[model samples]
Target: MNKKVFISGSISIKKLPKEAQKSIDNIINKNFEILVGDAKGVDSLVQRYCASRGYYNVKVYSIYDAPRNKISDKFRFEKVEVSESVRRKRESERQQAKDQAMTRDCDYCLVIWNGRSKGSYANILRAKELKKGLKVVINN
Candidate 1:
């Protein structure tokens, strides 16, 4: 059986860390079910790489009514909603919902992070709270 891997990372990086890319490539064969969000940055980078490689065993979840990248259409999708108060709504909260859902659905997470961004940090924290293992690929 294949493991379900949840992937997330920072938005600030224009280039992915070599270790993170290695981790991604390592998990992307026929033995993995991958999950990722539909947001930009790491999500987009992973999605593009997987799509280009014709990986179909992926789920691209996103918040309701949000436009995702075109390549994400190739995979299955789950539309999510934010529980935050509408009056205080923010895009980050919406993305949090999507990433949180990914956390809940995966056996573990691969955090492609540089150890500073909030979103990637939140994903690591959420996985820790869920008692799921997180393999962090720190920047070199």
Candidate 2:
């Protein structure tokens, strides 16, 4: 079976470095089905790249629809929406759900860490707790 990978990363696109961009490209080229939240920043970049490359199997899970940005129209993806109520709840539960979904659906979780964001840290903890294979891509 083809490997399925969940992509979690800094939403701050402006902070992404050249190395991080290349790493994401490499990962996408490996034919791993990508799972990401289709928000702004790195998520948007990855989704747009996959779409432009004709990667049909990419899936986006987000709390909202595509952001109001100018991503290319060619990027097509399956979207799973997480209800807003989940975000309003306790942080632990939200992180649990995110981790659960990723673990249940993906073979590996690739996290692009930008800095000291709490959400990113929570994801790291969740990945560790689930014992899923993780690849941490640091973009400094």
| Top candidate when judged by TM-score against the true structure | 1
Q: Which residue pairs clash within candidate 2?
A: 51-75
lDDT (Cα, tens digit) per residue for candidate 2, span 1-140: 88887777766655556665676677678877777665567667767666676675676664334533325444344434456887788854554465457556777777777766566667777777888788777775
> Candidate 2's C-alpha lDDT?
0.65
Q: Write the per-residue lDDT of candidate 1 for residues 1-140, one digit (tens) a residue.
A: 67899998887666777787777778775458889887778888888878777787888887766547536566887777665573276778667778888999899899988778888999988999999978988762
**lDDT of model 1 at position 94:** 61
Candidate 1 global CA lDDT score = 0.80
- Candidate 2 Cα outliers beyond 4 Å, as residue runs: 64-100
